[model samples]
Target: MSTDNTLPIEHLRWDAASARGPRELNADATAAVTDPGAGRWAFAVADGVGDNPAAAAAARTAADAAVGAATSDPRGAIMVAREALADAPDTGDCVLVVAVGGAGDRCEIAWVGDCRAYLWAEGTLRQVTEDHTLAAYFRARNLPVAPGMEHVVTTSVRTAAAELIGTADVPLPAGRLLLCSDGVHKTLPTARLRTILERAADPGGAVTDLVDTAHRLGGQDNATALVVDRTAEHTANSSAA
Candidate 1:
């Protein structure tokens, strides 16, 4: 949130965690890249479904492929990720989010499952992805609230089929882009997340705060967060002024 204009191609911050009661390594991974001379960059995060062993592998594989594909075809990155997952023998679930083309000041985000992407600007937090969850479905149906609601997952990469693919392209306004897994979201309320994002000095610190907060609040699953900060590039002509 520092208004420092000299920070080059903005800064991206991230964080991740596992379930609260202790578990194996967090089934999540992320990647970030900034083309030295191009001023363009990519940031991505993947969350593997817990119910399937193959989900973790699929998630990591998809993330790697997405980042690599973004270098040439940013839009194709999602397709590449999807195809890669399909080829893998893992029917597990995964979620992906990426931002590229800094020069054009555009961001491309894609995802599957409940993992989410958010944009923070003007002191407001807006969720960019609709959760593919049973709770979301029920809410959409205007169904009455019921107990054990949290147990239902209407949509996820791990669900029977790969039906949760979605994409969004938006202008990267001067603010921040946040990508996170369900572990962090399940534990911390959105308001708290907003406060942390707004207050953190940089992306790294923000991601750390988000993960730490989830752990303190009883992280019941693997938690992860990725932050990308965007600002206008200062050209020599502009700097001379």
Candidate 2:
């Protein structure tokens, strides 16, 4: 999708863990940019896989590379990130999600693993990405799943090299878009998430409530979230009229 109209946007990012009890720092990083010239805005989140010093670094590397590439060429962002990962010392897995907003209410997203993006419009919530997890596969296969067993993921950023990329595109209306890590999904059900997004005073409040809800539910993993709200940008010619 592509848009010709400019729009106002907002973003936020947070990390609230150090990898369990003694990990010292969370192994995740995120970055975003708004490019009016290109009529697009890009945002990405990268999660380091495994318990290693380089995990966080790898995540940062992925986020930085993805965002940098998006700035120049949204289509090339994933390729740039993949190349960066190839050159970096193999540490573990990392998942990436990149969202690009464009003129005419167009939005595109690319992702790997379970990191997710959601769009809310007209009182409805829609998830835009598929989770590449073992559990998801099982469910797709019509297997019976027990409660509390859903966390046993089979695919993640740490997955084998062959399964590290996923992508999607959608038209974004004048509403809210949510980009988040697994922690938010793990704690807050989709119903609750929708409610929060619907009632949130602003993008910042939505992100805060998301993280807080995860912590309240005994946040076992690092929690992070970003919220973007869209508003039409008035051009000089349009405004003058």
Per-residue CA lDDT of candidate 2, range 123-230, in tens? 899998887676777789899767544555454443434335566678676577788777777778899899988998777778788877777777777777777776
Each prediction's RMSD to truth:
4.9, 5.2
| Candidate 1 weakest lDDT stretch, 10 residues | 1-10
lDDT of 1 by residue, 1-241 (tens): 2212234543333333334235465677776556646555666777776745676686788777777777545446767777777787645657666556555556777666677888887788888877767677788889975745654556444333433566677666667788887778778899999999899887778888898888888876777888776643432323344
Error of 2 at 230 (Å): 0.4
> Which stretches of candidate 2 lie above 4 Å from their native place?
1-24, 71-75, 145-164, 232-241
Listed in order, each prediction's TM-score against the native is 0.79, 0.80
lDDT of 1 at 53: 61
| TM value for model 1 | 0.79
